[model samples]
Target: MAASIDAYQREIGPTAGQGTESRDGVLSSPLERLSALHRISQSATASLDLDSMLMTVARVVRETLGCDACSVFLFDPSSDTLVLRASIGLNPGAVGRITLPLGAGITGEAALRREVVPVVDAVSHPSYVDYPLLGNQPYRSHVSAPMALRSPDRLIGVINLMTIEQRTFDSEEVAFIETAAGEIAVAIENALLYSETDAELHNRISQLSTLRQMSRLIASTLDLPQVLELVSRQAAELTRGLAVEIYKAHPDDEHPPELLSHYGAGDDVLTDRVRHQVRGMVDEVVGALGTVERSIQVSPGQRVEVMALPMLTGRRAVGAICVYSEKHLGDDPEFHGMLHAFSDSAAIAIENAELYDEARRGWQRTSALLQEMHHRVRNNLQTVAALLSMQARHASSSEATVPLYEAVGRIRSIAAIHDVLSSGSISETTVGVIAKHVTDEASITTLPPDTRISFDVDADDVWVSSREATVLALLINEFVSNAFAHGFSDRSEGRIEINARVSDDVSVVEVKDDGAGVPDGFDPGETSGLGLQIARTLTESDLDGSLSITRRPEGGTAVRVTFRSRRLPEDTIT
Candidate 1:
């Protein structure tokens, strides 16, 4: 066994030593050793994975030091034991499974005393502990170094190197090993710091993601119950599956709280004892206008801790939510702050839902009252038109009948305003429908039986404020009435065309007739007729527009009006 061990050790010893020497066979200078240490440091600290980093450090150090065997052990303060983490020549299976107390073996003593242990003959050293599983031939020379990483030199772990030759390690070699130990300490500390920072960064990212999700879910709907349920579910997720309940605080403190939503675990956690305890906490939170926390024993052996946050809108407390956890969450300020943020979101959601509900109800009431007012106004206008018709029948003169007919036409024009409003929203009205109704109504009232008049209306469906639509309708009525009465009076048959369009942010209406042209040199503002005067007044004063009459080249008159198109604001009336 000893001969075979010699052969095995010699094979590995030379192969490992090759990493530390130049091809020229000169001993490695101090500069070369320092360069090797730099390379080893880079490889060891390259990964944040501590296990892999420590393994790389062990392998690199053994090869750099020209040793046949190496082992790395980490100290666990909780267990008070040094655990073998990585090794080269020792039983590979012993790594991670073998543990030694703080002062049990040479590695342990080195860790306990924060010093180096060197043995020329491991079999003769009183501090050596035998591992029968790690081959029969004992390595003759050994060196152990404790890894210290702080000012007081905190011992974190130990590294051991073994050789087959019964030779004492010179001071220079021992110093090199110590240098390697320093590199290992820095690598281990860097990996642990990186691991902690990565964990914290990931946790913050997850929290931000949860906040975004909660905002989306809460803003998705105006339904009160659905919002509460979503808040409960999100609160549960934020607390890592803790039981959550949302309660709406009644305006009267005497009234018991109304449960809005509950999620996670079950109701058994909310037994009578727990419910009563949580109620008191909630009241205190609402009364104090802040958060409250307490722990309670629900059953003989079961205890639940709760954190309650008041949902506040401005300065008023609207409701509160309780998070129940098996572990105490009161002492954690981070968790408390998270709960407060969630509660604020819930409050805004509740306030918005309530406002929406109130607005809907108010709109319904206002709509009903407006409909009734429009119905009464339309009936009164129709009654006035009917009275004028009766009076026109009673009079047997053309002059009397003409004025009565014009009066009836004007009344019908005003009635058309209410007709449009009653059918849809009162805030906005369409111009096309009013134009068609007025033209059709005027043709019926003004055209004589002997004179066949064809009335055609072409108008775009332009939307405008209701006040603007009424003015435009009156102007349309006067223009269409004049076209029939005077423009086509001399002809036995004629055609009247009304065209309305929207262009360049302006509304254009053109009324043309195929009849005798306007009297030569006659001006619209100077016309002695009331109908022409009314049309001009409406166009300039109310509609903020201009009116012009030009004789068509085809022996007719064309009346054109242009006005700025006033459009309603989006989502205001619709």
Candidate 2:
């Protein structure tokens, strides 16, 4: 311990104990507390709990001096005042005057000069003010030292050694008090970190809870105004804002946006109004104004200028939440982060509500259109089937009769699609129905009953509007009929796999055959069949996709077609 202090003395200059009278017999309490503080100082571990660390420092001060009053004052460097943070054995009323200046008293003078002051008589000192601790009794001896453990080298507070006795506080006692002062500074730092950690954790939990509740509320309701209002109110409360206001934008005049839904304008009306008046601000600062998700805080003079957070619905900026106050209530990095979390929670709810409203309207319109479409398509295909039956009856040769019967079978396959579409509440049917219909018509069912064709679908039910769905169904039918004609001609045991999935707004369908693969010199586009040509036209130009054919690694030909979605990619694929 002595050797450590000797090394510290060289770096910090010799202690006040270097040359002074030592008392042989004295109170052991001061030395004992000093020894305990020495052991704590030797440690290099970090503390995260602020209250416990600050309370421990106060305990050491009370035990060391054996005094009835001890308090720790930390300097708020921004506020530039010695704030009375933690106290022991001191009345709450006495804490206000606990804050002292740079050279006001014995403690202040020691801090200002960056040295220890050991005054045997307080009456002799010019700066000795009557502290509330001594009551009406005169103060005899006092020892004080400046705190310098923390960075930015300013006096945090002073640790004062007070005794009512007239005996001097010798260099030995002064040395112990000065080292104790440094340890108090570290305790102050740890306490500040603990306070920050607690506030951050609390804000994050509140944000997550608000998002969960908002999700449930939006899912069950269709009222647009109510959805907007709930998002704004919850955002304000979650962030602990002074006030929150929201705006809803219009489609045509989105260049100069409109206010949609707003709450809490009493705190700052100007800030609530400034979001729409952002033409100049956006041009001068932050450049782009297309979509905003970040928060902005501007202070003008002593008052807060604005605390603005943007709310986005989908890729567009539908609205924003603005909070205002007369004073700079929240002016830190952590506070700004909490505001951003609040905005994120609100925006997601707004987007979900908008999407739900759209889906409800889409299904109602599409269901009615599909029923009409099924009636018209069934009539047209039956007309073509009746003409094919007429052609089969007029044919003279057996060879010609076989081709006429094949044409009539294709017409029946088209008629079966309307049956599936008209049977359910859904306007669309699976690719499974279309594939199974074509294979059955082409007499691929002549094989054993156990042999099956499988449809391996990996995507959600993608609702294609009328024309697109019909074209895609017919396109898949042509490919399967062609596969049955040549590839599975002599195979009694076989499997056909139809795989479909959606990726990045593109829905892909891959039809693979486990039987004989594509022949050596056969190109699909070179076929004279009108069925293959129609499939190629719909897959390329109509569906906005490309067709690919590959031999599978396990001896099969896979026909892959990828098509784009009409809408943007979202949580729901369709």
Candidate 3:
């Protein structure tokens, strides 16, 4: 008994379902009979433990058949190939090294046909081959038997054996092998049941993980682009998925997966394939309505689960989550469940982002309105000054009251600026209008017809506000008036030129004359009073700027006022 045990254990240890033969005579000892029954009992026991069955098959074939080796080859229905799953004979490497096509070898042929191949002599059989690992042993005769532990109708795999010497197995040995193979089929069926149970546990774990991470991401950000990017990355990482894609559902197209972002381990070619499928045509997206199961068509006809999670901001679908997978993980139930749960978070984040965008747009509109109002206010003030002018002129006595008259002219010049600003659209304006009006109003054109004076305007029309317009216009009037009063008193050739130009976001207004220059070291802020004080106040306070009085290269003093224009900085101010 002990010797038989040693032979079975040592020889079958390396043979994985390897087929061997037993003696032709019946089992003479009670222990031998006992071992055969134990083999059948292990096979008959109903358990979903496929691994335990493989181990039992290896041990039983060696002990009962009294063979050197045994091996089990299971038929994978998807491929129709006999995959060598477990073995007890041959090298440690060769245990899983071999695979036989269905109907290709002795074991494969037997499994494919669900028949028994009992070879009485090894050399006579056509299907037998000299497996290298068993060359050192005295293998001669063998048997191949088919068994199905999964679907009873389908042959699961084949059980094979090899013997030490050339011999034929009798009726008793054949019956024992047949009964043993049937028991193995039962073991296989049990193992598969266990696989399904395990697979379910894994799916539940995965679904929970996805829900947790998705919650944090949807709450963290209001930026639409950023949120989309994060969603793609998180889905891939959490699921250990082959690929992940996020799509935005638009009005024109249903499936236009606005590939917000993606992350994965594959190459650019592979990732690009995912990009195309998620953004599939509109018909495809609409087809996803109410219908649960969907798949994105990939380059190699791979079936990736297409999940449509409409990023519902209110009732409409603002976007969707188009998830994909290259590998068919049997986690479909959990994957579908999680997809539905995460839709709420996705919708909330999208809503928040859209609201923030609307608020920003409103703020901009209000700012434009305020700027327009300021421009008009400034223009209206200038117009009031103009009305005062007509009144002052009718009230004036003569050139004898020239100082009083001069004061009124200055007042009315500023008044004209306020009127222009008030009448026109003030937000978009030009100070040049004010400058031209001032020089024209204070010139000989308006003075007595005998004391002739002409105005020369230069430079482009520099557009500015009615506020800046009034300040700059009044200053020009004062400076030009002073030149006419003092320097051009007994004029040979007198001309006042007002030039306004803009540079480096600043507006420059220059008043020049071909008369006597300013007194040695004269500052308009210091010397020219009443009008000058007002001019200084208008420049520094009203315009929030500066005034420089310089001698023109041609002779007269040019009063240059530099100031800021709210709209001037932007070439296209609305």
Candidate 4:
């Protein structure tokens, strides 16, 4: 350190002949000067915080030099100016508000020349610039030294010292201040590096958080327009851009891409040049299946940067997201990675939305066709029933009329199932609904005009497949017809009740009538009636179930059928 100080003194040329004394007639010996230099160095290297470190250095410099005021100015490369960063005696508000370009004043000249400048009378100096806002005092002497580093030598800032009395800064004092300036420069450089690293880390964490949020948001919906809008807004926020636009690529090259969504100010403010450039970028990104960037000069000394990234699903490009900003972006690999992740998520969401739309359309068409088929079938059955009815009405014998009417009843029962199926779900229906339809048809066609026959149906929300519903409807019709034909022959008033329920994965349907009981030797399995035979065959074969007929103790007959209920898949009606 001593040898370096000696070199600096020799480089500064000869000192003034007068001894080192302040306006108070106090002399500063060589030992005292060395102590002050040591103190300045310690203060500069004490902290990594730029503001606190610079302020401490400014205070120490004032005390060490026995000056009335001290201020530290840091260089801003982007604006090519020196900004007042810290001060010990100037107006507190002017610390960060004051600025000076190189060669503008005494401080700027010292920075521009990379040397120490001393003026015995600051007001009389040619380069002196007065700043009234800085709380000016009638000081006669001033010194400004540029802070510079050695290796890769670059100017960092300038340090200014002012006194309230006329003073001449000797060569030794100037050299000591220069040495202190060097220490301050090194500290500033280290602090700046720390700040940059801290900012970069914070930015990375924020990007990850934003990407996670976007992923969850886009995954919540399958609506195409909503997905596009979400992606546009998220892209703008992610890049900190002024505007964002999403373009969907057309299948044909003759047509330009469509702007699906946009966020930020409308395109009225965009120049023709920018619009053309964005179009070109979109085309490039789509063609290359990668990211593309372009910068256009919007006006004198003003430029706009645009980046377009392809939204890819697998190897195919679905669309492109374009971001516009006044600052340069997309140059960092980390930034590029974040963009790719966001674009990939957006592409997947778009693809899923489109697929869902297509599937929904196909389902609608299928439903329409099924409805038409059911309608035609119901019409054909009604025509058949009408023919049977006409035949029964024109029959010569009552026995012949009875069979025809029975056939008509059977046809109408099947048609009723189709009627309910056509109106709602094609795959399934409630047992209660089918029972209601069948009983309604029977009451209309089978009941005599003078008879008071009422049906009471109670089915507790047991759902079945369309095919099962047809079989159950047929079975119920048979039981109802039998009760009307035989059970209530001598009675003027009667009631038939149909009840269906499910228990422990087993389905049970019962039909009972308060009328004459079955004969002593009657057997369902041995019955000669065609309807009973059909019911038994269907119950055993198609339904995979058992049918039972019993005499009710209350002077009636009840028929019960049990089967293993089919398990409905997810989203199927219960």
Candidate 5:
């Protein structure tokens, strides 16, 4: 017996001598609780490492309370379960390997209720659970104290202290253990906060590195297919996506473009049902003004997130890219920004590839080729207009359907410029002809059937390049559409007038509407809606022109845009 006591003292200190007077005296002293408290507080303050602190806490609580064993179980919010993080006096192997559901046993109950449960004899207690896998130590009584943070009782874990002999725990002993549990709770919260911040920082750094790689890929190759494949694969890796698919609308094809390349999990990444859904998402992005995100359910309870971005060459969408993943990254602003950055680079690469392909075909074919290109572009725009019409038909509200109608009108206006080029008039295309086409299309597509609206185009035949004609056409489209949609809201009749002529080596175009004028304080210089914003941007940036809106003297609004004249080769194609 003396030999056994001496061995035990060597293990934990002299105070651990079993059944000795010194051991009993030390356990009974008031200073023992204070000393144990001081030790736990010191460890908590010294270390931000949760596992080491939990182990120290379990050991100290078992020795101070004179118990046979101790275990600390931490709560997992994601799984809604308690995991045993630290233990002593049982199988050490089982320390970090066991879990119990909420309210499953005495420990679980304490954690769920945020209270201390003292079992005088757990062997006879109905709420006690026996797990032989935790080891063969037979504990008769135990106390489970919930470790929680205050101000709403956020439970972090439960601390269980057990004794071999059956005994009732006094209030003083329970109080001391609870104090230690409090310190453990603080340590757990601190560790979790630090871990989350560190992880976010790591992801941010990784995303920036991935974006840099994508930009390099863009600058490295004019091989559109190869660049598309590499960029898609890199994007999938950055977002941990299942796959990425790039689809480009070919101008020559009447139908929408096929998927040019798929990276990551291959074609099997999208099933039949998912493919149909993805096609619709891609179409919307190509038809709309900017990127769109959606959640698609690939299977009964499994959802895949998709980001559809249009590949634009200035104002026209040439194609779109779709990034797919099991997890949704739409809510993350940083990730969204990264998607836009990649989309911009992808657009530049696609445009460069198209130009290179055209150049390789020889400049001798440039005249016929440019004309053919314009015809193809016109066809693509008509296809977009058809899609928008279909979407507007199925839309649930006027607000939703209105944008589709506006987009269709804008697409057709650009198409009108191509229409004239396809007629063997590429350069020196009259702005008057483009304005007449835009006004006619907007009246047919936007104005109400019963509302009588007439369009008048009166101007000198001021000629500009196809690119210049495109910008002017879109400006007239937005102006006419806005006048028809917003200006005639209370009237049953209105007239839109388009006037263009040359002034001081500049083409000055004015669109006047005989409907109710804009609001008293409305500023056309600071327009906010998508349509007006597009018009304002094209005038200032694309046309190098200035736009202004003023109330007509005869109860209406008039908008005028003025820009310097510029000319390009009749056979130029970009």
Candidate 6:
């Protein structure tokens, strides 16, 4: 077995200084050593995959050196430690589970020194460290070489070799191992660079996708509180923050910044120290109309960072969004860009919601004023009607009382329109509502008490502008008045029916009375009566309509009016 081992080492290049003799008593050539190194170099860079490349290199190095074990440790800058990445001959489970600090053990010592360290008896070395999980191999000899790149002088890791037998490595063997370590370092650097680039690209895509989703959510509502809440929650998620707060800056400087929304942790769960720090950040950002960042130590050896970005619309500072985390997020340019983008979107949403709220309040004020004006107009008309009614009661002649009574009815008809307008939107009302009010008023006031005159009003639910409704009401009152005065003058009981129909943008209102018909050959166009003349003039001019009064063949009078039904505009309330 010893002779075979010697022959193998001679062919593969000797790793320990033995007698300068091969199995056949011939010296190994320098060409054989170069061939061994070339093989090791090729194995180191065989794959771009870090784990595969490291494992392959470890196996090749162990075989080339005729050693019992080889292991590769990679440097973790974040933790300032060397982690076992790949190994052969050691316990496979320990490959990635073992770790050592920069100057903790033999491997770490070599990494710190940037040189090769050899131990004749690893168990007796003062700097040696053992891992029970790696299993006991009774390795007596060990060598640790640090892997590094020269141009930039960056430390990659350390490569370790162990032997079960007591052996001493020569200068040539150490040089060979150092060259292999150099090749491994270059491969590791390349792989790490590729990984970092890939991670950055993936992070960018994820951030942009998150921003898009957040923008859509923010724009979905015009409610100010809802928008602020959405922005706070999404901002916390995008930044991976422990907590987030949105603060709205009051336009008046006397009022302090208001916390509009909060996400992540409840206020009772957060430490007072954290809340204070966040408040400070909010004040600074809002006051300066810019971004503010700070780092505060929450506990011993624990620090948290806070970043607040202003929500700006044009030159106005509307609010600020603050994110809290344990990471040094303020140092990252990508995080800044993402936060700024989200902040801009949040600002626009807040501004739009505020504008909508302001406009709604203004409209409410204007509507209230218009309603009050309608009420006053209705009151004045009713007063006029009452005064005229009192005047008719005092009149001595029936002829004088008749004209005054008719004027009072006309005034009341105009007042009915204002009464409807005051109760709701002034822009429009239903024709049916106006007809009912006018006909009911005429029945109560104009019909004689001794003679029973019943009124039946059937009007369609046709909507018309307030102006048209007023004219229609007066025309209906005039027709009803004329019926009460002339058509039912000598009748003990009479029926006055008012019917209105709307079709194809035209309206037709017919007031028919089962009472005395008009005098023979009566013409409404030439009537000297003020009531008929008023109705005819209103139908032609204001209502853009025509009126015809004809004696019904069944022995009563029917007055019909035809007009274009003008609907209110879209923005006007009906």
**Candidate No. with top TM-score:** 4
Candidate 3 per-residue lDDT, tens place, 1-574, comes to: 3344345457545432234233534465657766776755665463456666676667566656666667777777887887776665445455556767877767777877777787867666787665564331345676888886544476777888766566576666666677667777766766776688788677667667767766776677677778766677766655566665555556665234455655564554345664555555323544444213356555575556654455555456555655555544345655655665666566676667667667757755665565566456546644654555555566646643565556656666765665565455544456567767776777632355556667777654688754566666678778877777766877745777778888777878888887888766777756656767877888888888898887777788878888877764454322
State the lDDT of candidate 2 residue by residue for 1-574, as single tens digits: 3343234234433222223343333434666655766644533124556545554565555454453234555565675556555554434344445666667777678877888888777778898786544241333666676767657665666655444345565466567667777776665555566678788787667767776777677566656678878877886676555555565445565364445666665424445445544433332222332323323343343333345566654455555565544444455666566565556656666777677778867876776687668767877887887787787779998678756665666666666676556655444554555555545654432233444555444333554533555666666666665556555766755567765666676777778777678765557677767766777888888888887766666876788888885643332323
Location of the lowest summed lDDT over 10 successive residues in candidate 4:
12-21
Model 5 Cα lDDT, one tens digit per residue, 284-310: 777784788788887677778888888
**Per-model TM against the reference:** 0.66, 0.49, 0.53, 0.82, 0.56, 0.66
Clashing pairs in model 6, backbone N/Cα/C closer than 3 A: none
Candidate 6 residue-wise lDDT, 202-315, digit = tens: 877878987897778666878878877778878887888888888887877676677788898665435777777677777778779878888877777767778889998888
lDDT of 4 at 562: 99
Give the lowest summed-lDDT range of ten residues in model 2.
282-291
Give lDDT per model, in order: 0.78, 0.59, 0.64, 0.83, 0.78, 0.81
Give the candidate order by descending TM-score.
4, 1, 6, 5, 3, 2
Relative to the true structure, candidate 2 reaches a TM of 0.49
Error of 3 at 477 (Å): 38
Least accurate 10 contiguous residues by lDDT in model 1: 18-27
- The per-residue C-alpha lDDT of model 2 at residue 22 equals 35
Count clashing residue pairs in model 6: 0
Cα lDDT tens digits, model 4, 96-210, are 8999999888999999999999988899999989887665445568899999888888989999997756788877788778888888899889988888988888888888887
Badly placed stretches (over 4 Å) of model 1 are 1-52, 61-190, 201-281, 295-305, 321-357, 443-456, 490-494, 503-505, 571-574
> Who is ahead in lDDT, 1 or 3?
1
For model 1 the local lDDT of residue 318 reads 87
Residue 26, model 4: Cα distance from true site in angstroms: 9.4
The candidate 5 region of ten consecutive residues with least summed lDDT is: 14-23
Q: Assess the local accuracy of residue 164 in candidate 1 as a C-alpha lDDT between 0 and 100.
A: 61
